[model samples]
Target: MATIQANDYLIKVDEPWTEFSKFVQSHHYSKIVILVDENTRKYCYNRVKGQLPFDHQIIEIKSGEDQKSISTCEFVWSQLLNNDCDRKSLVINMGGGVIGDLGGFCAASYMRGIDFIQIPTTLLSQVDASVGGKLGVDLKHFKNMVGVFKNPKMVWIQTEFLDSLPANELRSGYAEVVKHCLIADKKQWEEISKYDDLSQINQWTNIVVDSIKIKNKIVGADPFESGLRKILNFGHTLGHALESQLLETENRLLHGEAVAQGMILESMHSVNHGKLSQIEFEEIKSYIELIFGKLEKQRLDINDLIYISKKDKKNFAGAIKISTIDKIGSCIYDFNISPDEIKSLFSQSNFN
Candidate 1:
């Protein structure tokens, strides 16, 4: 079992989880609400149901990036109200990133705020979304356009949940693992950089814990993203824009998939800034393409992506800001890339 002390709470990765039950029982909470999406309800809920010592009700919602919205929040609030949830109640968010984001947003907003814990099931939520307490839903897929920074009481993770993950979902979540290594841990990156058949790997416990350590350390220093924490957005600016633009399309990208492609694109941009060396830039592009596949740059609209990127939450003073790699495991945050530069990059057809 790996544990990290977060800014306000603890992050525990333990199977046969008993801490969750202990906490709820010890607090004698007025009510307990377990929130799940259809997927989690099927694959996760029953597995952990016996752990809760107290009675609780379940709230199930359809799962997807599209469901993380005001309408969903309204539905969650109506359920909380109908079930008589109050300040002393606890909301257990059980599922992947979308469920964690939406459920946390709802619990944080309901009755001003109520206590909640994150029981993230998917690798995406377990490694990236669940730890930071950065809770929110999308604004028309603009990506976390409306959210608040409210830490959960604790976060519990069980690696067994990943067994049910499809190959694509595993690849999607591994993007964050890749991002964490790219930004902070060179040695870790060196270890997993050439991984081809993801199915053969089973040290997920170590990988997940290590990734969380990198993020939690960054978050520990800059919980509000005022400075250091922004580096965690290494491949996210372009990644989020790409995710948003394709939100309604049949070929929609998962958050991590978009970020994987974004890393290759942004790493090339890094070379132009003179921070990332040419050889390293090629390495970034080559490895990312090997794992995530070659990005079909021709399929995207440069103008539309630029428009969506301009709306990125990371911007300040009207500048299109992003985190750029300085080297293999170092990055610079809030680096402003002008619109012309973005247009010019795609126009140059930088991909191989």
Candidate 2:
């Protein structure tokens, strides 16, 4: 098992085919249940299933953000019940973020927590979502509203699976890579910006290693998210709110796209406050736009923005804290800005 160490955690990166067998041989798991989505079942299930050393049951959920809810969890729990899944049975989350999050939740709640392995298929899952151990489902239009930080037994990243991902999904995962670079590594940021195509396996491997290292460093320092971990939400506050709102509409924005726009506006906020130079701010915006394209404005009510902002997890003692950039590779947190100031930044963002 190839290993990457995080604070109090070790991510075991294994070849997809050998991952299940390795887990079964090493651990005394009673049974294995592989959780997949429609997309993964079509593109990845056979390859994964063929490699398992033992006969394992499969649980497939429909593909889409709408499936990321408590109702879906109920369905999965029912499946587990019908299949006689117990605490000793292992759950292998074999898809992207949605499957990983929902499956992890199911496993965590089943018999008060069971071991689960993350077999992340998409680039986004491989690099960011699967590593942090933040598992949850959305509630009342909020993203990751109900969750827990339960680490997976192992995380198997198959770079080869990325070949089946849609181009937009590839672009979506790039945002987190960009976020990692912006928050910590200048060299990494430069390398990612310079490399255009993600289809190259060698390039992707390097990117994944660097991104995981950056995230692991931050998560190690603040596993409980009491301090430094808050910095990781730099673009996510407005980004996630915007994403939550937009997800309800017909014109949906991917998570990375929303975060890309969030980074732009947050950087703009930084510039307005004189915390970041105008040149630095503009460069950040330009680079994101170049890769993810410009953010298209949706007809969202100002009140909705307020409502969603209030739902942000970072609000402490009734004050919303934001993470902003003073420059690339550097971040600041706990900056209390007024709601009106946030609105003003949103208006001036020119997201269209």
**Of the candidates shown, which would achieve the greatest TM-score relative to the real structure?**
1
Q: All candidates' lDDT scores?
A: 0.87, 0.82
Could you give candidate 2's per-residue lDDT for residues 13-91 as a string of tens digits? 5445565487577887777788999899989887656677776789999998779999999999889888888888989
Model 2 lowest lDDT segment of ten? 195-204
Model 2 clash pairs are none
Clashes of 1: 0
What are the per-residue Cα lDDT tens digits for candidate 1 across 1-352?
Answer: 8888988798898755666687778988898999998889988998767767689999999988889999999999999999999889999999998888899999999999999899888888889986678899889736688999899998999988898888899999999999999999999998888677678778688889999999999988887778999898988998888887887788789889999888877887888888899998888787887888866666788999999889888899999999978898898888989989888766664553
**TM-score, cand. 1 vs. native:** 0.93
Candidate 1, after superposition: displacement of residue 220 in Å?
Answer: 1.4
lDDT of 2: 0.82
